[model samples]
Target: MKVLIIKTSSLGDIIHANSIISDLRRNHADAEIHWLVEESFSSLLNLFPIQKTIVSKFRSWKKNLFKKNSYSEFFQLKHLINKENYDFVIDLQGLIRTGIMCRSLNSFGFNKNSIKESFASYFYKNTIGVEKKIHAINRNRLLVAKSMNYEIDQNNISFSYNFKKDQTDPNSIVFISGTSNDQKKWPLEYWIKLAGLFERNNYKIFLPWGSVKEYEECLTIYDQTTNCEILEKMNIDQLAKKIASTRFAIGVDTGLTHLASSLDIPTIGIYTFSNPDLTGVKNTKTPAFNMGSLSNIPLPEEIFIKFNDLA
Candidate 1:
C-alpha cells in the first residue's frame, strides 16, 4: 500500500513520528511511505528509510530567498504529491495547514468530502482521533497505529544513527542547546557551569545547535569549558550519529533532546515550562531535571547530583 504521512514543522515532533516506520515496515513491508516536512528540516528525512520527501517552506519565510520561492514551490509540491496517488494519508500535525495539504492530495478512494479540523469530518475520508494528553511522541505513533490498524507495543521505538567509518567519537557527550521557542531554553550560565562539571569528570562536551543564533550560545560555553568540541555546520543526521556515539547527553527541551533519549542514549534533559512527563523518558537511568519555569532551571550543583546518581 502507498501511504503519505503529513507531519510538518516542529523538529521534535517529526523526529518522534519516525518511530512508526519500523511498524509500517514490519506489518506492511511493501508499503510505500512518503513524508511531508517543512523545507528547512527536510534534511532529516534523508536519514529515514522512506519512499520520498515533499517539503514546503512554511517556516522558511524568514529567509529572503525562501520567501521569494514559496508560492512556486507550493505549486510544484502540489503537482508532485498529486502524482503519487497515495493509498492512505495521515496528518499527525493536526493543524489547518496540514489539513489543507491533505485535502489537496489527488487520491482515488476518499469520499470527495473534506475533513474540517474542528468541524474536520469535512476534510478526511477518515479521521483518526488523536488526543493531546499523551507525550507528543506516543501520540504521533498512536495516530499511525490507529490509522494503519497496527497494535502499538510501548517497547517498540526505532531511530538509527549510523556514523561514517572515522567520525564517530565513542567517548563523547552530546549537548543539545537549542529549542524552537525562547521560553524553552535552559539558561547559558547553567550550561557554562554544567560544562565545567563535565570537563572535570573527563567528559568531552559536544555542542550541536542548528540556528546561527545558537553559535554564540555554544561559543560562550565552548570557550570557557575545557575538553569540549563544538560541531559546526552539521545536519540533523550527522548530529544524530554523533549523539548516538556519546556516553551520555545533556540537552535542553529541544528536538535533539527527544532524538537522543528516543535513541535510548542515556540522556539527561533540562526541561522548562514544559512538563518532563510529557517530553522526557522516565524508565531509563536518564534524569529529566525540570525547572517549573524555563526562567528558573536548577543550579549546576543540583544537576551534578543527578548526573552523579546516573553514573
Candidate 2:
C-alpha cells in the first residue's frame, strides 16, 4: 500500500507526525510512505524514519507576493502529488492549503471527517475524526492506526535522536535558551537559580542560543553561572545531533527543547504559558518530569530528580 501523510511546518509538530510513520511501518512493513512538510523543515525531517519527503516552500515565497514562480511552484507541487496516485492520504495539517493540496491527489482513503479544524474536512472524500484530548503524538498515532485499521503502541512518544559518544566533557548538561513565545519561557531569575544549581552539582553547563534575543539571554545566564558556557548560533539540526551527545539537557518551549527530546536525552523542559502534557520530553517511553507556570519555577533539585529516571 502507498500512504501520503500531509503534515506541514513547525519543527516540533513535524517531529511528532513522524511517529505515525514509525507506527505504520511496524504494522505494514512493506508499505510505501511519503511525508509532506514545509521546505524549511524538510531537512529536520531527514532524521525521521520515513522514506520520502515532499517540501512546500509556500511560506518562504509569500514574502514576495508578486513572484510568479511562487504560485507556479504550488501548481507544480500539485502535479507531483497527483502523479503519485497514493492509495491513502492523511492530512494531519488540517489547513486550507494542505486540504486543497490533498484534494488534488488520488487517495483511496483520506482522514478528514474528524479533523481538529472542521473546514479542512470539506476537501476529502474519506474523513475520520480522532480523539482530541490525547497528547498530539498519541493523537496522530491513533489517527493513522484508525485509517489502517491497526493498533499502535500507546506508550510511545515521538523522537528521532540517535545517541553519539562525545569526548569533550561527557558530563555536559545543555541549557537550550530559545522559544517562539516570551510567555512560554521561565524568568531570568529562575534561569540564574537553575544554572547555579547545575553548576553546584558537578555538571558542565552548556548554553545554546537560537536568536539575538536568546543570545542575549544566554550571555546573562552564562555570566550568572560560573560553570556555564554559551554556544554560538548554529542550525537546529546540528544542535539536535549535538544534544543527543549531552549527558543532560534543560530548555524552555523553543524548538531546541523539542529537538533535545528528539535526541532522547534526559531533558528538563521549563514551561510557562504552555502545558507539558501537550508537549514535553515526547517519545520518551521512560518517565518524565516537567516544570511549568509562572507561580513556581522548577528548581535544580527537582530537575535532577527527573534525571535519575531518564538519564
Candidate 3:
C-alpha cells in the first residue's frame, strides 16, 4: 500500500502527528509511507522510518504568494504528489491550506466538529470524528486507526526514532528555556533555581536557544547558574542529536521538549499558560511529566522533587 501523510508546520504539532507512523508501519508492513512536512521541519522526518520526505515551503510561499516563484513551487509540488498516485492520503493537519493540498487526492481528515477549521472538512472525501479534548498524540492515532479500520493497542503505541547515541552524558540535563510565546515561559528566576538544584546534585545543565532573544535569556540563566552552559545555535537535526545524548530534559511548552519525549527521554514539560490535558509531553516508553497549568506555575523545588523520583 502507498500512503501519503500530510502534516506541515510547527514543531510540536508535527511531533504529535508523528506518533501515528509507528501505528501505520505495524498495521501495514508493506506500506510505502511518505510524509509531507514544512521545509524547515523536513529534517525531523529523517529521524523516523519514512520512505519519502516531501518538502513544502508554505511559510515562505505564503509570504511570496503573489510572486511567480511561489506559484512555480506550488505547481511543482502538485505535480510531484499527483505523480505518486498514493492509495491513502491523510491530512493530519486539519487546516484550510492543508485541506486544499488534499483536494486532488482520495484523502481523509478530521470532521467539521473535530477540527478547529470546520471549512477544511469539505475537501476530504472521508472525515473521521475524533475527540478534540484528548491529547494531541492520541487524537492523531485515533484518526488514523478509525480511518484505516484497525484497533490501537493503546498500551503499545510507540514514538520510536532512528537515533543512535554517540556519547551520552548520563549526568547531563537539557533545559529547554525557549518558547514562541512569552506567556508560556516559566520565570527566569525559577529556571536559575532549578539549575542550581541540579548543579548541587552534580548534573550539568545544557541550555539551547533558537532566536537572539532566547539566546540572551539562556545567557542570563547560564550566568546565574555555575553549572549551566548555553549550547551553540543548531538546526532541528543537530539539536535532536544533541538532545538524544542527554540524561534528562526539563523544558517549557516548546517543540524541543516534545522532541526529547519523542526520543524516549525522561522529560518534564513546564506549562504556565497552556493546558497540559490538550498538548503535553506524553509517551508510554519514557517518564513524561507535565507540570503546572495556566496561571499556576510550578515551584522549582517541586520540579526538583519530581526529577529525583524519576532519576
Alpha-carbon local distance difference test for all models: 0.70, 0.72, 0.90
Candidate 2 local Cα displacement, residue 231, angstroms: 2.0
Task: Put down candidate 3 lDDT per residue, 191-284, tens digits, no spaces.
Answer: 9999989888899999999999999999999888899889999989899999999999999988999999998889999999988988999988
Candidate 2 per-residue lDDT, tens place, 29-91, comes to 988888888887777766666678899986866786688987889889988998888888887
lDDT of 2: 0.72
lDDT of 1 by residue, 1-311 (tens): 89998878777878778777877888789999988898778887887789788887666543554464866666677677777888778877665545656675532111223222454334566666555556666776777777778887764556533234245455678877877688878788888888888777677888887777888788888888787778877887777766777777778788888777766666677877677666664323343444334455677788777777764
TM values, all candidates = 0.83, 0.88, 0.97
Q: After superposition, how far is residue 275 of candidate 2 from its true place, in Å?
A: 2.2
Q: What is the lDDT of residue 11 in candidate 2?
A: 79
- Stretches off by above 4 angstroms in model 1 are 60-72, 104-121, 160-170, 281-296
TM-score of 1: 0.83
Candidate numbers sorted by TM-score from highest down: 3, 2, 1
Would you list the rank order by lDDT, best first? 3, 2, 1
Using alpha carbons, what is the TM-score of model 3?
0.97
lDDT of 3 at 256: 94
